[model samples]
Target chain A: MLSAHDVTRSFGGLTAVNHVSLEIGAREIVGLVGPNGSGKTTLLNLLSGFLAPTSGEIRFDGTAVSARRAWQPSRLGLRRTFQLPKLPARMSVLEVMLAGGRLPAGASPWRSLLTPGAVRREEAAFLDKAMGLLAEVDLAGLADHPAGGLSGGQQKLLGLAAALMDDPAVLLLDEPTAGVNPSLRRRMADHLRRIREGGTALVIVEHDMGFIGDLCDRCLALDKGAVIANCRPDELSGNQQVVEAYLGRRRPGVPLRVVAGGTAGAKSSGARA
Target chain B: MLEFCLHVLIMSAIFGIAAVSLNLQAGTSGLLNFGQIALFGIGAYAVAILTRAGLPWPAALLAGMAAAALGGFAIGRLGRDLAAEYWALATLAVAELVRLVALNEDWLTGGPQGIGGITGLFPGLDGPARALATLALAAALLLATALTARRLGETQFGRVLRLMRENPDLATALGHDIVACKVKVLAIGGAMAGLAGGLYTLYLAFIGPDQLLPFETFLIWTMVVLGGLGNVAGAVVGALLVTTLYAGIPFLKDIVALPSDLTGSLRVFAIGSIVLAALMLKPQGLVPERLRRLHAQRP
Candidate 1:
């Protein structure tokens, strides 16, 4: 479980996220949606400890993690993916997955040198585990391929596989379906559902309304760095402010809620199509 | 001819030890350190000073290694927030700063004249016998360090370092303390370089500030590049090749009746051209690094 209190992050004169607070419960999937420059990614960055908040406190299962290094929160079982997946040019896909596994002993230089037998055994087990995860993401065949050479969609899938390698308690994904094909996007949705059933929580920042509407249990809509709507995904269309933010100013004669509802349906349908 | 061959072999093994260590840092981890000689210098000076203060050979050698490790750790710490290029420049500056200290501190470092008359590891043996013993010692040390470096490279620690080199942010996301990893690598590399320095001093019975020049660091880099950057065995071979070339180039003066001064610069020119050819023709070096297979034999 994770919670933030009045978190704000700014860069120079730009206030990207202002007085935003959020909580993510165990096994829950929360969708973060907003138009461009709405601070969705910034909020995710702040929550995942990739970037420190300009002001506010964040706690993960009761431990303050704001002052900790990005890696520290990760050790506490919180993991995140970038908007554009980070894959090194020289690293094999399997190597990337192996790096993601939780094996502190094998990571120690001393243990690696002095007790190589133990390290080898640990590595063999992890190699199997990583291979299995890669298979789940339909990347088992490309395990030996240089990760940087993979297609964008494949890279995103690899990113997911790598993050899952940590067996993280909470996973934050930024636009996982951004460049993915429709079939792969559907597969990812199924994967996330299984992950939630397995007791891990998720926070997804996405512009794909249909994906968010179908997958998210709850949704938060933002405008200009402030939360404008907090409701079930189905109820997002009924929120007047969210509609105005997405579809622009309402016509004077018609009830804005109905217009908002109609447009949300059209948008989600178009997105799915 | 036998003595000349042994001299070349001994020098190659000594420099090979340092080259292998540098490979672990720059080749394996992508640290791109440009101050490698400084760590080597620290080791040499630690031995020189500690021996002068009446410390035994083995103890003085270890103390030199520890001192060099500390210097390496300091460089790693300073580069924590720097990008790769800036960090490289910082390493260069630190190396120059170190050379300056050795240059200016006359009483401690014997000024430009350097310290001499240090005892050799095998003082009782004379002539070729002593050279043979020193060659054997250097070869053994090189073998040990190379094996250790190779073992470390095959482990998950090596995978983590590759990740750090390739994508520091991603490595961090995977819960690796990258700064700590950098420091650890530098320390290990520094210690190995230190060992090589101590052996060099013991082999020659002297050391000077001139040996710590920035050009020495570039020579190590060329060794790493000429061998596959990430291949441990390649580093050793590269060192041998380069050292042999350096030693043999002066012989051309005899055949061609060249000017005396030209031989010194000729070696540098020959090395520079070989590096360029290597880069353009076989950028992966003589022994290109292979990707670690998941089903590869366990180390």
Candidate 2:
């Protein structure tokens, strides 16, 4: 469980995230949606400890975590994925997965040199774990490929796999389906459902309305860095302020609930297509 | 001629040690340590000071390594809040500060004249035999460091360091303590350079403020860039090549019939040209680093 109380972040005179409060309950999947500059990603950054808030407090489970640095939150079983998917270009997919595992005792320089045989065995176990996770994502076949050479969809899948390496309770995913293919996107939605079933909470920020609608239990809509409405994914378009925020103006006769394919409020059945 | 060639070979071995350490820091971990020579100088001065104070060689060497490790800790603390480029310039300043200490503190370093008559390993041997012994020792140490590098290249620690080199944020997202990684890397690298410094001082039987210059750091840089950025064997290859040319190029002055005054400048020009050519031909150096792989059989 994670909660934020009236968090605000600013850069110089610009208040990127004005005053937003959010709570992600255990095993709950929440979609954060807004226009291009409505501070969705910035809000995620603040919650995940990438950016300290100008004023407000963030708590994970029950501990005060506002001043903690980026890596600190993950140690508390809170993990995040980058919006643009920043996989190391030269590392193999499997190697990237291994990096997500707990930092081992063999990682120490002295320990690595003194007990190389033991270290080798430990690394073998880590390799096995990473390979298992790759298979879970249906990527065992491409584990040996250079991460940078993978397709965009494959890269996003790798990011997902790497984040899960920590086995965190709370996941903050920034656009996991941004550049993925339709098939992988569908698979990802299925996987996200399974993740929720396994009792892991997720705070996802995505522009793919259909994807968000499919995966999210509840959706939080934003307008000018503040919460505009909190509703079900299917009920998102029906909200009046959310419609005005997306269209930038209210229509005389049009309801603004455009829930067709690729339209603003595309409806997703929250099931495999 | 044989003596000069043997000495050059020995110096390259020492430089090989320094280059290997530099590769671990700058080439793999992406920490630009312009103070590498400062750490090296710290080790040399520590050993020099301790040996003069009646400490044994082995104890003196360990003390020197500890001294450089402390300096590395300082770099980590001071560099935590700074950007990468600024950290590099800060290291350069650290090197200058180190050299100034060695120059002004005549009680220890002997200033510009340098400390001399430092005893070497197997000091009873003749010039040729001593060269062989020193070379053997250097080779053994280099082999140990190389083996360690290879072993690390296969582990999670090495992967994180390599990842940090490319994109540190991704490394962080994976739950790696980036500053902790940097500090450990710098400390280990500084220790290696310190070891090299100890061997260098004993081999030359002299050290001074002149040896603490940033140009010395660049020589190790040239070796790593020439051989390869992320490969241990590449550092050895680059060190051998750079030191060979460095020792051999003076003969070029006589062959080309250049003025004696221009010899130093010509060597610089020649080395610069070689580096430029290498960059043009192979930007990643003679051996580009390969992706680190886990040895698990595909299932």
- Return the TM-scores of chain A for each candidate in numbered order: 0.90, 0.88
lDDT of 1 by residue, B196-243 (tens): 888888788788889989999988888888987889988998999999
The model with the greatest TM-score is 1
Per-residue C-alpha lDDT of model 2 across residues A155-211, encoded as one tens digit per residue: 888888888877889999999888788888999999888777877899999989999
**lDDT per residue as tens, model 2, B249-288:** 7787768887776877776776787688878998788878
Against the true chain A, what TM-score does chain A of candidate 1 give? 0.90
Which ranges of candidate 1 are over 4 A from the true structure?
Answer: A250-273, B296-299
Clashes of each: 0, 0
Tens digits of lDDT, candidate 1, A1-273: 899899988999999999998898999999999988889998988888888999998889888876357788888888898889869878788989999987777899899877877887887888888988888888888888889889998999898888888788999999999989999899989989988887889999999999999999999998878999989999989998887677666456956454454777544443343
lDDT of 2 at A183: 88
Q: In candidate 2, which residue pairs get closer than 3 Å at backbone N, Cα or C atoms, i.e. clash? A: none
Give, for candidate 2 chain B, the lowest lDDT window spanning 10 residues: B290-299
Local lDDT at B82 for model 1: 90
